[model samples]
Target: MALFEIDESSGLPVWVQLRNRFVYLIKTGHYQPGDQLPSVRTLAAEAAINYNTVSKVYVNLESDGYVESVRGRGVFVRDIGGKADDVRSIADTEIEGCIRRCLALGMTIDEVTLRMMDVAHRLKDEKS
Candidate 1:
């Protein structure tokens, strides 16, 4: 059975959604390294998405070193860093990159801190 269904209502691209889903599956130990993924055609038919979309997602994942494709075999997850805190590591790396870019643009530490706090506050308000 398919493990996840994409959220059609989300503004994110289908490929991005697929990529996130597979990543989460791996991180959560739902898909271990060497576990074969459903064939692209099968998955596309199941997801009711275009074949090209799923193919692109798989291709991108393979290129990102997240998955491997073997001739006459199938796509399988790769052992990427093997850290339980992989998500946090990724988030920290991306956030650090953003902070560096902001700093390069002459943004101040206090400005960035205040803006982040405001964003968090807005999120908290939304949950209320």
Candidate 2:
């Protein structure tokens, strides 16, 4: 599967979906600091989305301090530093990304909820 996927049917706007996915990847360590992200045009073409949409996402990511775009170079993930205070926000972003993925894969909300509950229970058990 591609690193970036879009769900047109999702209630979330395309830019929002893209933004949340980017944050989730960064926070999860899938995108390490200094790792270069795809150029706006490249990612737009790859995701079959509009250039402006990708551009907006990249701009927002940069503003959020998740990445830095070096002129003539490319967008690279930033060392946002100290994830402690960001734990809640990161968790929310991840949950949203997971639900979006499940919906894109044709899972109903009920199915997603059940799966999530099961996973949560398993995680809680592991912590015991």
Candidate 3:
């Protein structure tokens, strides 16, 4: 089975849904630099997704510079890039995702603010 689960009802496109999970594996340090990813055929079979879809995901990952495909060695993780501009782009995406979920949960501005602060502090503590 795949390392992540998909929610078909989440209103996200299949590729997007898979992409987010796939990227998380990289971003979270689960897949280290030079670590090979599962073969496309293997991932496709595990996720029960189309082979084409898996190919598309790999292509995007390569285009984004997050991974590379060696001729016969399969795909491997690239050292993740985190330039200032890239950080900002990722932060914007994260903010939008958080806001959408908070809104859907009917959270008040004050509640969201507090929750954000609490989570931020907890994360900072964990890092320290």
Candidate 4:
């Protein structure tokens, strides 16, 4: 599977997308503590993003305590105490945004909830 993807049509900034994906990977244990992340240039090439943009994301991730960069070494994931609250907060914000967008499109809460659950199940099945 591809390590990263960029949705040009999502309207989200490229750096934000890369940062969020790194956060999700760290929170999901996909990249364990002390695991070295790909170098900025490598990730930029892999994700087809600008090298500067990837570097900015790395800086932001480091500031947020999700990662650390060692001199002469690459960035690595930080433990951050598992920080479930932080992860949950990020997810909550995205979920709320999606709900608001759906509501603005005239979808009821029930419809959004049902559709979200259906998609979740479908994705789970696909993964299996």
Go through the candidates in order and give the clash count of each. 0, 0, 0, 0
Q: Write the per-residue lDDT of candidate 3 for residues 66-100, one digit (tens) a residue.
A: 89999988999998765325545788899889977
**Candidate 1, 24-118: lDDT as tens digits:** 77776778888999999999998898899999999998998888999889999888766547876888899889788878889898887787788
Candidate 3 versus the native: TM-score? 0.64
Error of 4 at 123 (Å): 9.4
Pairs that collide in candidate 4 are none
What lDDT would candidate 3 get against the real structure? Answer: 0.82
lDDT of 1 at 54: 93
- Predicted structure 1: lDDT: 0.84
Worst 10 residues of 2 by lDDT: 81-90
lDDT of 2 by residue, 1-128 (tens): 57887766679999999999898788777888999999898899998999999999999999999999999999999997765346567678999999999999999999999999999999656544
Best by lDDT: 2
lDDT of 1 at 20: 90
Higher-TM-score candidate among 1 and 4? 4
Give the backbone clash total of model 2: 0
Model 4: weakest 10-residue lDDT segment is 1-10
- TM-score order, best first, reads 4, 2, 1, 3
| TM-score-superior candidate, 2 or 4 | 4
